[model samples]
Target: MSKTKFMGSIGRIFIASFLLCLAVVVIYPLLWMVMNGFKSNGDMLSSPFSWPRELNWQNYVKAWNRGVSSYLTISILVTVTSTLTTILISAWAAYGLTRVAIPFNRLMTTLVLGGLMLAPAVALVPLVKLFQALGLYNTYWALLILYTAFRIPFCTFLIRSYMLDLPREVDEAAEMDGASPAATFWRVILPMCRPIIVSAVVLNVLFTWNEYLFAMVFTSGGDFQTLPVGLTSLMSKNGTDYPVVFAGMVIAAIPVVVLFFASQRYFIRGLADGMGK
Candidate 1:
């Protein structure tokens, strides 16, 4: 091959090697967590890297009994509810902002985008008070609202950017056929925006699933604590049970990791479309 082609091929190999190494780095912790979850407390601390000669499935049972099972259910509820609302509300808002021209559209978009700049830490106090007054404090509703509100700006931005890349011809054609804006959005726009929607849904799932701060603060007690918050309490109460803690961590990670792998294609497509434009 010519020098140029040879250099290009070498670059490709280097990029592939870097990516493979990156994947290993990212996945190693998860692999270790899974392995340790099958180990006894002594084995976990004794040989952290080496595989066990005998698998101890009892760690998972102990972890489950020590609150992981309940925490997992709570995490699933919060993640699913928060993600669904975030996507629906944000997608509708984005489609409206991009397609429907109203007065001060730019100002509205800026205001919404400005939400992205505000740190959640700054709003935590007021959010707590607001939820308390609204009687939503320390409940799934509190978590759902907080997660949805916090996630809106990014989701709106992503969905809006993706919608911009969609062909305007589809909208015009739908309009010419006497389709209303709502119909056009639902029938024509939504289908085309599926990739971004999937990406947004997955992103929101990851966030809401793994969230600890808000879940810790907004929820004080009762049936309100999410997986992260619950896991912390579980760990504190069972600090000596290293295997159980590892198992709980693994359980907490499994759903989001599985969902990410399942939706990775659409996630990548959405990211590419949103960023490429």
Candidate 2:
């Protein structure tokens, strides 16, 4: 083979090897967590790397009964509700910022993007006071509101970037046909924006599902705890029961893993166009 072609082949092989190692680094912990969940605490401590004595289904059952089920349900509700709202609100904001002839548009974009820079931890105390004042403390609404609000900036940025590349011809054609701006947005732009919408939804789902700080602080009651907080509580409650804790973790991880895998294609497609610019 030519020298250039031979070097290109070597480069490809080297890159592939690097990525394989990285994948193992990322995936092995998840495998270990799941595998260890099937083993007893004695087995975990004594022979950490060895196969389980048996699949300890009891661990899952115990964990589920000990608030994991309730925590999981609450997480699902918050994630679904907040993620859908975040996407809708962000989509409208993005569309308005992109399509509407609003004043101070540049300033608006800057403010929206600026949200990505703000630290959620920094606002915890103030947010706590505000929520308590609003009578939303220890409630689902606190978490739902926080999730939607924090995610809006990032989601709006992505959707707006994708929308910027959209052809104006369809919008103009719709306008000529006497469709109202809202109708055109609903029926026309939204349908065409599916890839990015899916991407934003999945991204928000993962965030809301895994988010701990807000969930922990906003909801004081056990009935309102999410997976991350619930898992922390589980660890404290069953401090010595490693298998049950691990089982709770596995339960917590399954939905996000399934979601990312299922929507990965659209997720990547959606981000690619926006991030490229």
Candidate 3:
């Protein structure tokens, strides 16, 4: 073989091997956690690496009955609401920033994108006070609002980048057909931006599902608790029931994992398209 062809083959082999190892590194811990959920405390302690001798489905039952069910529901609620809200607002903001002619457009873009730099930790104290004053503390609204607010900047950045690359002629065509701005956005732009929107939804859902600090702090436990905080609480209370704890973790992880895999195509494509733009 030619030298160039031989080097290309070597490169492909190296890349494939690296990706295979990376996949194993990422997937093994998740598989291990799932396996442990089917084990008893003794099995977990005795043979952490070995497969469970029997599938102790009772562990999952116990986890669900104890609190995972409620936490799962709350997480779903928050994730859905927040994801929808964030996407709508971000898409609209992106459309306005990219399409419409407005004064101080650069300033507006800067201000909106500037939010990405604001650390959530820095706002915790002020947010607590503000929420408490507004009678939103310890409420689902608090989580929904916080999740939407914090995520909007990044989502908008992504959608705006993607929108910038789209042909302006579509906007003109929609307008020539007597479509209103809102109609144009909804009918022409949104459908075209499906990849990025799906990507944003997946990302927001992952964040809302796994978010712990705000969930723990804003809600006073019980009904408002999301999966991450609830899982931590489960671990604390059932520290000895290793199987149950693992079960709760597995339950918490399943949705996001399923979601990413289901939308993997759109997710990767969206990010790639947006970044390339």
Q: lDDT for every model? A: 0.87, 0.91, 0.93
lDDT of 2 by residue, 1-277 (tens): 9999999999999999999999999999999999999998899989987889899999999999999999999999999999989999999999999988999999999999899999999999999999999999999899999999999999999999999989999899999999999999999999999989999998899889988889888876647999999987766643568899999999999998999899999889988877665
For candidate 2, give the lDDT of residue 160: 94
Off by over 4 Å in 3: 237-239
Which candidate leads the pack in TM-score?
Answer: 3
**lDDT of predicted model 2:** 0.91
Task: Put down candidate 3 lDDT per residue, 1-277, tens digits, no spaces.
Answer: 9999999999999999999999999989999999999999999999999999999999999999999999999899889989999999999999999999999999999999999999999999999999999999999999999999999999999999999999999999999999999999999999999999999999889888888889989996547898888877766643578899899999888888899999999999999998688
Winning model by lDDT = 3
Estimate the lDDT of model 3: 0.93
TM-scores for every candidate against the unseen true structure: 0.95, 0.96, 0.97
- Please give the TM-score that candidate 3 achieves against the real structure: 0.97
Please state the error at residue 129 of candidate 3 in Å: 1.0
Q: For residue 105, give model 2's deviation from the true position in Å.
A: 1.6
Query: Deviation in angstroms for 178 in model 3?
Result: 0.7
